[model samples]
Target: MVVACCFGMIEVVCVEAKDIQSAGLGPVTLAIDSGSCTGLTGPSGSGKTRLLRCLADLDCHEGDVSLNGASRESFTPPEWRTQVGLLPAESFWWSERVLDHFPYKQKPELDSLDLSPVVFEQPLRQLSSGQRQRLALLRLLANQPKVLLLDEPTANLDQDNIMRVEALIAAYRNQHRCCVIWVTHDRAQLERVADRSLTMANGRLDGDSS
Candidate 1:
């Protein structure tokens, strides 16, 4: 899809991973178009998470990953991470107060996740797992990343909250035309959110007929 960037109406291939290989996984190549979501499903140890880490340049792996046609090597690690953000299955909070981790206190994105502004005043240890998960997502979105690598983003939430998170993600993708690589175990979720689905087995990905 065409997006209006600083250069004015440029064609951006949101994400492209060429010959990506990590422990147990074979060479994997895939391209995710702008404003699209790709569902990745696989067994517990099938390297699904590893693949995302590789794409985020978080893990040591052999691959060529590019965002908006710019190679991973072109940017500093922090710069690249800001543009291609990854939300791990379990988020970590380094600060005592929840607000300390965020750059700013006010963000409209918080409301979409059903987070009250008061949450910023609470201690990180007081928040439940589900709350932390939702907050993590909000933090990621606040960066306005060009691509999102989400690993089981809704795993800790109830059905209602899961739908809320999904809706927020879909809205974000539509607004920014960003690419999403979502790792999910729920086939129904894949059907609901993804434009395409792929299954990983023994470190290799294949198209999913389901």
Candidate 2:
């Protein structure tokens, strides 16, 4: 079910996009509920990433995207981003050390990624790609965004780490009632993690398939 809030007889949406379009991509629209993970699947170049970019305010596009009953325009870019965070396939690093990139020195969540407290002081170049990917997620989570736009967040992870990442996300979603739009190619992963699934093709969302 698309997660929603009810007040007597009225239902309020979490994330709602209306005719959102970017360049050669969608004129797409959809609403996702709080606490639901919606799997988005499509061929490469189908505009999955671009759509996410629009929602995150990282790309300029027509149509409006709103969250938690407010429009994106209601907040400044940084504030909007903090509320609707996007975790891209490749993370951008601005600091030399792992700890420098984070707001806190000791993130307990690192243990779930098989990382230890000592890792915080290590330079970025010393970490593996998988480690960087996992840490990027933790960095994003620190903001506690009300919405999560994940673009293959665990693509670089091994089987064990993939499971760990999935569990971590699920727990966070349930605990916070956050909405998730997860883009992935793995159909099995969708089944395991998504409460609803949508297929995107030729620059638009086809329909709900899950």
Candidate 3:
């Protein structure tokens, strides 16, 4: 299904996975609509991250995933991943300087996260955990992905920064009409951001009862 919005035509099922199964996770099915946020919460090692990886095609798993009605098999791994971006808890930095990783000039989004322009000049090694987490989110948004798979995106931030990140993601989704699948342990945070919430247990999504 599709819908017309300010961002143009958006697929209701922007992301769909049928029978997705990984080593630790059971066969799972999920459908996420554009401009909506779905919260996924589970105990540690319950395969929440694995499910996100499967959706991003970052790991080998059974079943199929489609984005915008296009099957994952139709595109190259890199091409598919560009449309369905995953922001892991611990972000990896390849270059020494931060600016080298970004192709275009910085935008005001940085300031919204309370990040200074000088942060672009700093080396990756010098950044704190929270800094890396916030910068990682910025990097993901720069890609202009249709779907976002976030795993504990605000784990390292304080309450103030957490709200900042949540607002930034909400604003971005509203503007782009993108789909968001956020995995977090905080129930209150889930309520704040997710249009619908689901709980995972023993590697399977149990219910939206949360």
Candidate 4:
């Protein structure tokens, strides 16, 4: 196994998660393979979100990180970010209507996620939090990212919405051979969707559970 040295840290980038801030993420180490789902679960402030950010290269740290055998430094930040998508915990929508947000001139099958194309026309504010979350998810999936970083992705949804999100993620993983790192407190959700699981504490990853 090859390890990358970023700034002075040695680690694998396939799916490394570590704390990058001064507070630190508590010394977590984890490696996930391609085309599978891995979960990060723990109490709030356990560095789960920070770990996600580090993998996305959104945070600065001494640990090494890479993707598909290439160091995160190998690609320009934009390229890395585009291929390694992060669905933030809180997303913004500025349009008066939802349909206005997506500019899909050539209508494609929204079927992958079981989302209704017409729902995009509703006002952003009019949609519930769960609907907004689903919309954000659709937007990310539309990008066809190679790696997915989701932060509390279903925090605002009902059972139906949660299932939809899981299905969409699963579909993406199966079809594109993409990797997923989900940060959630939902144990049940993790068990249902993740192929492997890990817990975060302080600033580090615990033993990987499959």
Model 3 lDDT tens row, 43-111: 998889999998989889999999878899998998898889999989998888787666475553688
Give a tens-digit lDDT track for model 4, residues 30-75.
6666676888888888788887777778877666777777777889
Candidate number that wins on TM-score, 2 or 4: 2
Q: RMSD of model 3, in Å? A: 2.4
Estimate TM-scores for all models. 0.91, 0.93, 0.92, 0.82
Say which prediction, candidate 1 or candidate 4, comes out ahead on TM-score: 1
lDDT of each: 0.87, 0.87, 0.88, 0.75
lDDT of 1 by residue, 1-210 (tens): 454554466656788888998788769998888887999999999999999888888888887988878898999999999999999999999887776666675454577778787777788888899999999998888888999999999999999899999999999998888989999999999999998888998888876553
lDDT of 3: 0.88
**Each prediction's RMSD to truth:** 3.3, 2.4, 2.4, 6.0
Cα RMSD of predicted structure 4: 6.0
Pick by lDDT: 1 or 4, better one: 1
Best by lDDT: 3
Model 2: residues with Cα > 4 Å off, grouped in runs: 1-11, 104-108
List the lowest-lDDT window of 10 residues for candidate 4: 3-12
- Clash count, candidate 4: 10
lDDT of 2 by residue, 1-210 (tens): 232344333335789999998886788989988778899999998889999999999988999888876888889999999999999999879989776676665554677777777667788878889988999999999899999999999899999999999999999998888989999999999999998999989889989787
RMSD of 2: 2.4
| Colliding pairs, model 3 | none
Candidate 2 TM-score versus the reference = 0.93
